[model samples]
Target: MYIRDKKTSFALVADKAELDYFHQVSVKDCASATVYSAYCKMTNDCPAWLQAAFWLRDKMSALANVENIKGFHNKKPDSPPKAGEKLDFFDVVEISEYELILMSSDRHLSVLIAINMQSNEGTSKNLTITASVKNKNFFGHLYMVPVRPAHSFIVNNMLKKVSFK
Candidate 1:
């Protein structure tokens, strides 16, 4: 890790890859991180709401004249990401057997999302998902002012709804 910040109450340890991703990102405004978790088969059958998030994101992109050049926004995944694979709404920044890093950027802002799965002592697996955002310009910050809260709400709801059969 390039820089170490105090861990949150959740004690989320940013992995080297995560830190590297952030290190490479340059933001005029603050770079923010938020984490969400769920008890589910994380490597498979990702939550529908999570996919819905991208669908909503695509509409927003259209309004801003950001074309979905990779066509990933509309492609829901049935399996874990491969190293060179494009994911639903973002480019595959990096990936490993246990970690998946996805990123997207426009004139206004850049975002990185990481999803990781680790086995616990019991039946359910622990899924940690983190999102980091960097603003490219003033409008990015202004647009995110209210959207930040809503973003948290959406992530919380998506995580809460994720469950395995």
Candidate 2:
């Protein structure tokens, strides 16, 4: 598959090859994708502290009228999804047999979580969760200064959570 310019972002950890690699492999033997690809891995299942941080963020961002980054539509789900079904929780863009594309956007940036899969055999498979962020303005570029470094660290740890089943 080909990467579109619209999918490009200033993500610190995720790259085009990474996202494409996941998309290429994610369809086989996989029914659905994970949430917060990297963030939840860092915080250990979306802890209370993270929730508090988000609360603060929402309030603060509203003050500046800047939009907060919205990640996965759902943190946990009782079941998998069906194509064309709007996610009950997350700000989803689209869902298909092979991939789950979650999205969020604002004046500063647009983020997409492309949850992909690949299979090695009838029983073996892998999940490639990639986050892509694109800067929308000068402030976005400036804001990424610190965010990029943090993202690199968080994403590295997140990879450890991957399991080949």
Candidate 3:
């Protein structure tokens, strides 16, 4: 279903209980691209600024003993990723023609990200990205302090850059 007007809903996600945080952003009139393609382009090809942010995050998170995740890089795949496969830091939970769901869990928290594509009147489509987080401990809650606002900025920037050929 389309995530219109930034409505908060976890209808597409299975594990929705006890979510500590949730956010959604929708982009209108997106260029012609499959749901998988759009998600890959938006995430895999990390911009310089975003990569710098991730680098800082990795270094800081290390103090808490969190595993250093392989930050996003320009590694676009040729085909759709399969369920149970790794898509950067997330695990591909589910994927279809119109939607994709990814999850990542650690000792501190579990994060779920959903990408949905809804066809519009013409060639354009509406693309929405939703993120839900469940904090597993005190560190998880603290980790989100900076990440929460940063998430909004990062998603907005990434969505604006998404343009399919």
Best by TM-score: 3
Clashing pairs in 1: none
Candidate 2 at residue 63, lDDT? 65
Q: TM-score per candidate, in order? A: 0.56, 0.56, 0.86
1-165: candidate 3 lDDT, tens digit per residue: 112223444333334455688788989877638778777667766878878888888998999999877577577678888999988887888889888888888899888888888888877788888888878899999999999989998988878766452
Candidate 3 regions exceeding 4 Å error are 1-17, 163-165
Could you say which candidate leads in lDDT?
3
Whole-structure CA lDDT of model 1: 0.49
Pairs that collide, model 2: 9-133, 9-134, 10-133, 25-117, 25-118, 26-116, 26-117, 26-118, 73-90
Show model 1 residue runs off by greater than 4 Å: 1-64, 68-79
Off by over 4 Å in 2: 1-44, 52-56, 67-77, 81-90, 156-165
Return the lDDT, model 2, position 85.
46
- Scored against the true structure, residue 6 in model 1 reaches a CA lDDT of 50
- lDDT of candidates 1 onward, in order: 0.49, 0.48, 0.77
- For 1-165, candidate 2 gives per-residue lDDT tens digits of 224434532222234544311212122233324433322332345445445545665665676587654332335444545544445323555454445666655676665666654555665555555666666777656555655555554454445555422
